[model samples]
Target: MKILVVDDEPDVKDLFEQRFRREVRNGEFELAFANSGEEAITYLSSRPSEVVLILSDINMPGMSGFELLRHIRTDFNAPPPPVVMMITAYGDPESQQQAAKLGANDFLTKPLDFTVLKEKLRTIA
Candidate 1:
């Protein structure tokens, strides 16, 4: 499975790599990272169908993840749109509701729990 991880934090790539090392090494998953919403959008535009999942941070510098989610839902016309999982440090009810309204596949809290994330991915895969 191919997943695009969008976050402004530079260390996120390393963290995810460490946490999912086995899966990555075994070729069960492939991950790509984007530092901002604009970068993520650019990647998506170029490789619309290459990614199966997107894990995005809600509070980004340029374009917010919510806005990106809206654009994805609007622009990506594939029959089975890529699953978007919104991640936020705030974890507020309003954000969660908004993400659901905007068509996010899942909502995750920051300081992420890899075990839970793995379980969720298991269901998706």
Candidate 2:
């Protein structure tokens, strides 16, 4: 499976790599990174069909995750649209509800629980 991770934090790539080392080594999944929503959108536009999942941070310098979610839902509505999971540091109910309403497949709080994330990925796969 191919997954795209969108976050402004530079260390997120390393963290995800460390957390999913086994999966990466075993070729169970391929990971891609984008530092902002604009970057993520550009990447998706080029290869929308390649990614099966997107994990995006809600707060960023530009083009917040919610906007990205809306873009994906509006422009990429092809059958089996890529599954999107939104991550935010602020675990507010309103943001969670908005994300769901915007078409996020899952909403996750920051300081992620990788075990739960893995379970969700398993179900999707």
Candidate 3:
């Protein structure tokens, strides 16, 4: 699976790589990182069909993940992946509800448990 992870934090790429090392090595997953939502959009625009899933953080500088989700739901001419999971440090009910309303396939809170995330990814895969 080719997964795109969008976050503002610089270290996120390394974190995901470390957490999903075995899956990456075994060819079960291919991870891509975008430092911002704009970058993610650019990546997707060029290769819309490549990404199988998107894991995006809700809080970002220019384009919030919620906005990104909305864009993906509405703008893409090609059918992008239906699975977009929103991740955030804020796990409030309102946040969760908003994500669902915007068509998120799932919601995850930060300080992420990769074990649970891996299971979810497996189900999707």
Candidate 4:
């Protein structure tokens, strides 16, 4: 399971890599990263076969994760694995509903609880 993490924060990428490094099955899951939606799109376009999951932050500068999610579902058609999850500081009910309607598989709140996120991730993968 190759995973692409799209976020603006470098720490987020580092932390994720650190947390999951021990669990990954000898590179079965390679973690790639992109700082913005445009960069993520570029990576995806170039190596569509290398990505199996996406962990994206909902708020970003240019194209938000929601926008990215919409693009994937609408443009990528039936071939994509779907977004693994989205993280956001704003846990509004409306936002959650919108994410679901837009096809987000799951979500995590900001100040993320890694234990819970890991369990959820395990359940999926």
CA lDDT, every model vs. true structure: 0.93, 0.93, 0.91, 0.80
For model 2, how does the per-residue alpha-carbon lDDT over 1-125 read when each residue is reduced to its tens digit?
A: 99999999999999999999999999988999999999998998898688999999999998999999999899875778899999999999999999999989899998999999998998998
Ranking by TM-score: 1, 2, 3, 4
TM-score of 3: 0.95
- Per-candidate TM vs. native? 0.97, 0.97, 0.95, 0.88
Q: In terms of lDDT, which candidate is stronger, 1 or 3?
A: 1
lDDT of 3: 0.91
- Of the pair 2 and 3, which is ahead by TM-score? 2
Return the clash pairs for model 1, or none: none
Model 3 Cα shift for residue 8 (angstroms) = 0.3
- Tens-place lDDT per residue, model 4, 1-125, is 67788899879888988888876656646788999988888888888656767888889999998998888777654565555578789988888888888888887779889888767666666
**Tens-digit lDDT string for candidate 3 (28-112):** 9999999988898899898877888999999999999999999888765357455899999999999999999999999999989
Q: After superposition, how far is residue 47 of candidate 3 from its true place, in Å?
A: 0.4
- Clash count list over all predictions: 0, 0, 0, 0
- Candidate 1, 26-94: lDDT as tens digits: 998999999999999899999978888999999999899999999889987486789999999999999
Worst 10 residues of 1 by lDDT: 72-81
Model 2 lDDT-worst window of ten: 72-81
